[model samples]
Target: MTNEPTIRSIIEQELERRGYSLSSFASRSGINRGTLSAILNGNPPKPIAIRQLDLMTEALEQPEGHFYPLYVNECVDSDQPNRRRVKAFLLRCAEVGQTECIQEVLDRIVENLSYIPMIFEIGEELYEKGLREESRLFYNVVIESEKYQHSERLAISHYRLFRLSLGDDAEANLIAATRFELYLYRLPEDYQLDGLLHLANAYLTLQKWVQTEIYSDELRNLAKMVYKNYERAYLQGKAFQFRAERNLVVYYGQGYVLKGIALQFQRRYEEIPEYIAGYADLSWFVGLNESGKEEVEKFKLFAKLNTYNLKVLLGDQSIIPEYIESVKKHPPEILPSLRVIVEASNIHNFFIDDILEQFNIDTGLYDRADNYYRLEVSKDRYLRLFYHLSVYYLRKKEFEEGISKILITLKIAISLKNYNYFMKLIPLFERYRSFATEGQLKEYETLLEGVIKDA
Candidate 1:
């Protein structure tokens, strides 16, 4: 691959240029003659350790870190990459403004027989360290390499990339979804369930409501097939150890939540209660396991939150306060969904100060929620937040602020193809015009009318 000279060749050229003998150079560099010979002549190359490499570079009058990039490339290109050492070297590269060197090394090693998998491993290491952009680059290289096209690494890379792209960009979401679908297409039939789950989520973020429902149904049907097979295997006294890994409780609960969200968007509100019950049941089942206790409790809180919204929509006011109290017991950080619900309720109740209280929570908690939504990629949630913020501003008589917030929500609604929510906002726009000057009211009416005509 790379046309660049190797370390041995470089040293040879340097010596020839200076008319220095190998023995004399090795002596000056304080390296063992035999060891240096092996390094220069061995068919299977010998690598120089960092400690000795530093000494040799100084002895040869090379500037400090001049060959660090070469050293990193050597490590990756080696048959057995010293992972621990390579990672440290990469960090050094970053520290010394040699980050561009990473791409160079990757480009050179990409086609190597052993390096395809090594590159994927490096991507994983970067991902574990929360360097998603860097990890994404290597994953892209692995896919481009095409050496392990149908391998598990390919599937894993696509899945991780799909997740990383969520909440940030719609085009990125489409690309990620395609990659995930490719992964699922190559995976075995038994392994398709989780891929289907991810596929459903990607579609949900895209606001492809029909596709989201279809995948949600497929996921549920597949989970049922798997659960029935497990039951049959047990009755037949077959040794089925997959349940420990399967975790049907978690899968079914997730499937229920997905389906319920799709149904809610379709305005099939009555069916949501049954799905809520299913989620509650499975969550309770998970709660019985000691290791799953925390997850189960979180699910329970989410169930309560969902129920609160469902009840509010159904006009079942008696249970609303109880749900609110249950929700208020947990901070938004621990239960981020609560933040949206609380703010929305404040707007509905016209509690301006309550809406302002949200901004008063720890800034870190808001950061956590921001990052959470970035991963979850809920356009609906974003629209709702903007809508509530508009209402809060309007109630406080901050006309310009209110109009700005509502306009943003309208833009998001249009992008999401959420015509129903857009329609609902038209009346609110009309009501707010009462607070506007005659000129401002005309502008508001014209804007709302334009949106409706466009719809």
Candidate 2:
């Protein structure tokens, strides 16, 4: 059997070759001779910190990071690995962008299988510090090496990977969200609430109303169960057993709001009233703490806003003036309300020229790559609103403005890689092709060509 060289032996050989005594080596490496002696000669030699180990390797005329392989013996590959030393060393490897070193440590440690909990903790710490790329390495390691399929750590690792993977591509985001959704129920209640909500919203963004309804239904049920748990504890004058990422009210309210929106998109407008009434007034939702009460107030605002919204969607032209006034009172309500108003105008053949004109320039400025609003409205919502506006303008023979909106929506749909929006956009543009200028036609063809390449 071939034996691996130890750090002590490596230092001894280097010392003999260089003819440097401990005192001389200490002076060169800027470490105390006693500390060096303890590391090299103690009955069970002391653990060397990575910083000191790097210094010793440098004094031996070694290349940068050349000593990392030898140092893994000090961190792991022992009966009892030094956990503190291992964590610090791994973090330093990440900080210095030494991905290979991180992988090396992970490969050695995973053979034992007990290091996954520590690995997961390192992943969390790295994620919280905004080192997403480095954090991804740790989380992926946990996912691949963890032996227990149903463990919470495995679920959390999946969640972290999903979060880090989100980007500008709506198609990729949906893939990630679905992958993470499989593990959502494995999470603790607190995490499940957040995960299910995001999963539902992701489907909504991709215009998958059926999947949106499914997950949103899950969220509503889970949120109600959690509320009852809290309510029961409150009645008993005992502390609740759990907490969630947001106030309980947010989960409860958003569950209904999201499901309602999904149903509205599918034109199941009759079924939405029940969902709307779910959060319409939470004054009766018991046992709210101060933050929970704040969430309740926000739900009340949503209740009023969505009520006007529902009316307009049901083709109530009389409510347009009142809805416009309500939207004006709340800045965040404008985008969604505008979407409803524009779509309703097309449906009911009403005029909203003043409202459209008011927000035209600002709405027209949406970049294909980024979210224009500073609020909670997502890129998907913007894409929908922009498309419907194009339809409305085209119907009115406002080709210049209508074609402009089509091109804007086309750019956004391409950036998102959302095939559903592409389907809608291609048909709408084709119907109005005679009205488009040469440049706009060229841009549309180019965008479709890119989609073919991507496919």
Please, what are the lDDT tens digits per residue for candidate 2 over residues 1-455? Answer: 75988877988999989999999999999999999999988888877899998899889888767778777777775766777888999988777678888888888777767788999999988877888899999999899998899999999999888877666688788789879988988999988898888788777777789999998899999989988888888899997766456788888888998999899898888898899889978878777779888878877878787788788887888888777787677655667778888898888887788777766434443342443332223566678888888989888999978988998888888887777888888888888899889998888888888778978
What ranges in model 1 sit over 4 Å off? 1-46, 50-66, 72-99, 112-114, 128-131, 147-150, 188-194, 224-248, 283-289, 333-382, 388-401, 407-455
Q: Report residue 231 deviation for candidate 1 (angstroms).
A: 7.3
Error of 2 at 452 (Å): 2.9
Q: In model 2, which regions exceed 4 Å deviation?
A: 1-46, 50-80, 94-98, 128-130, 360-377
lDDT of each: 0.66, 0.82
Can you give the TM-score per candidate against the true fold? 0.64, 0.82
> Can you give the lDDT of residue 146 in candidate 2?
89
lDDT of 1 at 29: 87
Show the colliding residue pairs in model 2. none
What is the number of residue pairs that collide in model 1?
0
lDDT of 2: 0.82
